[model samples]
Target: MKLYYTPKSHFARKNRILIDALSLEVELVDAGNVADSTPEIFANNPLMKVPTLVDGHQVIYESDHIAAYLVRKFDPTDSYQVLTNDVNQLNLRAVMNGVMTAEVELIMAERSGINTQHLKRFDKLRATVTQGMNWLENQADLFPQQPSYAGFHLICLWDHLLLYQMFQLKHPHLQQHIEKLSGFDCVVKSTPL
Candidate 1:
């Protein structure tokens, strides 16, 4: 199996952590800078997105779908509960994805020479991120005590936020959770370059 990813993408980082945590023997292919059109990613994914997985004749795109596929294929019993059946975990995952989407949009806009602070859509995007963060803070107890799928997503998002300096997250509970898992080998090995 081959997983196409960019080192700095929070989306790709989620899968990388999962692969490492499960000790899956998958080839990691850097898709180059996603900011530009990359033929390699485009060949496997029509959308040209990172976190695309190629297993034999099957091609998978989208980070969440790829994660589900990985868990089902490599860890069918989901011993790690990386892809849980719990509603709270599923909802948390959706919220995290929303925040990630908003961040990516704001980043792309800023890179295109647009002053995001002056645009209404950008304002909405910022609001989405803030709302997501607020929701996560309120449901802090739902966070897993161990490193699971939702926990990995939160860690990846937190790292991305720090990397881009896009938002100042002051939630103590979330901070504590991240700090506790910071030393996990899966996280340590997958730290973005």
Candidate 2:
């Protein structure tokens, strides 16, 4: 299996954390800036996205979907369920996904030199991320104590926000959660890329 990913991609980082936790070995290809698609990667995923995986003849894209595939194909002990099986956590994961999507959309717009300086859509995206953070803070008790799938998603979002200085996340509980998650071995190994 070969996985195309950029070093700094938060979504790709989530998969890396899971892959390490499961002790899976697969080729990691550094596909630079996903938007600037290379011919090989573009051939594999027409959408030209990173975290695209080629397993046998199967092509996979999207971080969460690729994560599920990795767990099913490589993790014989079904350890992936530790990350995917909780319904309540899944709801938070959905919210994180939405926030990440909106944040990336705004980022893409900015990168494209679009007029996002005062755009309502850009502000809305920022607000959405804030709301998600607030929700995560309120549901701190619902979060699993261990590093689950939703935990990984939350950490990835938090890490992205920290790395890019995107937003001011003032949720104490969520902030504490991220600090705790950051100390995990899987997360440590996946850092500095």
Candidate 3:
């Protein structure tokens, strides 16, 4: 199995952490700048997205799907429950993904030399991130104290936010939740520098 990822992508970070947590023997391939659409990434994923997984003849794109496939295949016992059946955690995970998408869009736009503040679409994106984060903050107590898949997703999102300085909202509960789980080896190893 081979996992193609970008170093700075939070989505890739989630799967990287999962790979270590599950102790899977998969090759990690750094797919240079995603924006450049390297042939290595494009060949595996038509969309040229990060966190693309290749297992034998099967190719999987999208971080969530790759995580699910890995958990289902490598972990027959489902010990980590990476694909959680819990509805609340599933919903929280979706919201975290949304926030991540919105923030990534904003960062990409800024990097493209676009004045995001002047665009209505960018405004909506900012609102999506802020509102989603606020919701997550309110539901912080619902998150597991241990390093589950949903917890890892939330940690990745929070770390990305900090990495980009995207928002300044107060999320003390979420912060504490993340801090509690930060000592885990998988998380420490996969954290972006």
Q: Which residue window of length 10 is worst by lDDT in model 1?
A: 35-44
Q: How many steric clashes does model 3 contain?
A: 0
Flag clash pairs in model 1.
none
Select the stronger candidate by TM-score from 1 and 2.
1
**Between the candidate structures 2 and 3, which one is better when assessed by lDDT?**
3
Best by lDDT: 1
lDDT string for model 2 (67-167, tens) is: 88887777756564533556776888788888888888878887888977667888888888889888888998777676777777788888887777778
- State the TM-score for model 3: 0.95
Model 1, 85: alpha-carbon shift in Å?
Answer: 2.9
Q: State model 1's lDDT.
A: 0.88
Give lDDT tens digits, candidate 3, residues 89-168. Answer: 88898899999999999999899899998689999999999999999999988898767888888889998898889799
lDDT of 3: 0.87
RMSD of 1: 1.3
**Candidate 1 on 5-95: residue-level lDDT in tens?**
8888899999999999999998988888787675565445878788898899998998889889999888987865776779988899899
lDDT for 50 in candidate 3 is 88
TM-score for all predictions? Answer: 0.95, 0.90, 0.95
